[model samples]
Target: MSARSVEVRLVKSGRTKIRYGAELLADDGVRLTVRAPWAGEGGRDFGFVRFEPGDVFTEHYWRDRWYSVKEVRTGDGMLKGWYCDVNRPVAFSGGELTAEDLDLDLWVSHDGATVLRLDEDEFAASGLAERDPEAAEQAVQALDELELMARLGKLTDLLA
Candidate 1:
């Protein structure tokens, strides 16, 4: 049979609403390989730094975890860095794949140095712990593991 592919959507969960962030494509099933679209905001400003809109990312996901590692690149194919999201593993159904971004993130620069941890405050304010304690704990654990991996320069291996 031919390989299966499904549309991927990243949803930002809010107190009373869900915001659609980006739409992409992913290989079907539990372990998904997603190709996320370039940022339409012309790049995202992380406060400390910014990524150009031309930057594209490829994400790797496992169904039983809390994070996904995304390899970021420039429009000209230059490797920018690796941006990882601490989120729910992923769920696929009805021809669409979805993931809940848990707010915490780890960014490892292309050279493997300059790792930046982002959005902890937002995560704390998210009330996720109160809503789903288990998932919140899992998300924190995932962030810790990702930070360790990025520090050890092992994140690049995920892309392969």
Candidate 2:
């Protein structure tokens, strides 16, 4: 099986002069969208990555997040899987989570779109609020993967 990589960078951090953001570097040099916090980190800093989810949650403030590789499954078969997440030490809802809160869950989709599944009911009726919000976005800029591949002299060879 073929594979790819997702490396998380401290685009945005508590220790940086500029506001924090996360960079998703695909194994193929595809960079996903770099986004700033709708809010911002309260005290967290540092970052880490894990292949599979585990009980290893960080209690201390971290400056970075973790990246996990995911397969890019296609109906035809599969291309490859490479993805990451900024919720390593899983971040909690930064503030009070309520139905009004715009919560987002990040996941890589087959169509190359960064999938954000919003849980309105959870935010509205549950205590999943008043916590740090996780940094969410697609592993790479969806529209740019192909463009980037071409620039690197790759795309054409990726045919099924």
Q: TM-score winner among the candidates? A: 1
List runs of model 2 lying over 4 Å from the truth.
1-63, 66-69, 72-77, 80-86, 90-104, 123-126, 131-160
- Give the per-residue lDDT of model 2 (tens digit) for 1-160: 1122222222222332232222222212221222112122342322221222111111111112233223332233443222322223222223211011122223333344333323335433433333433322221232234334434544323421
Give the per-residue lDDT digits (tens) of candidate 1, residues 38-113. 6445666776446776676677877887898888887788887888888787887665667778999988888887
What does the lDDT come to for candidate 2? 0.27
Q: What is the C-alpha RMSD of each candidate to the true structure, in Å?
A: 3.5, 15.5
> All candidates' lDDT scores?
0.75, 0.27
Clashes of each: 1, 33
Cα deviation of 35, candidate 1, in Å: 1.9
- How much is 130 displaced in model 2, in angstroms? 2.2
- 46, model 1: CA deviation in Å? 2.3
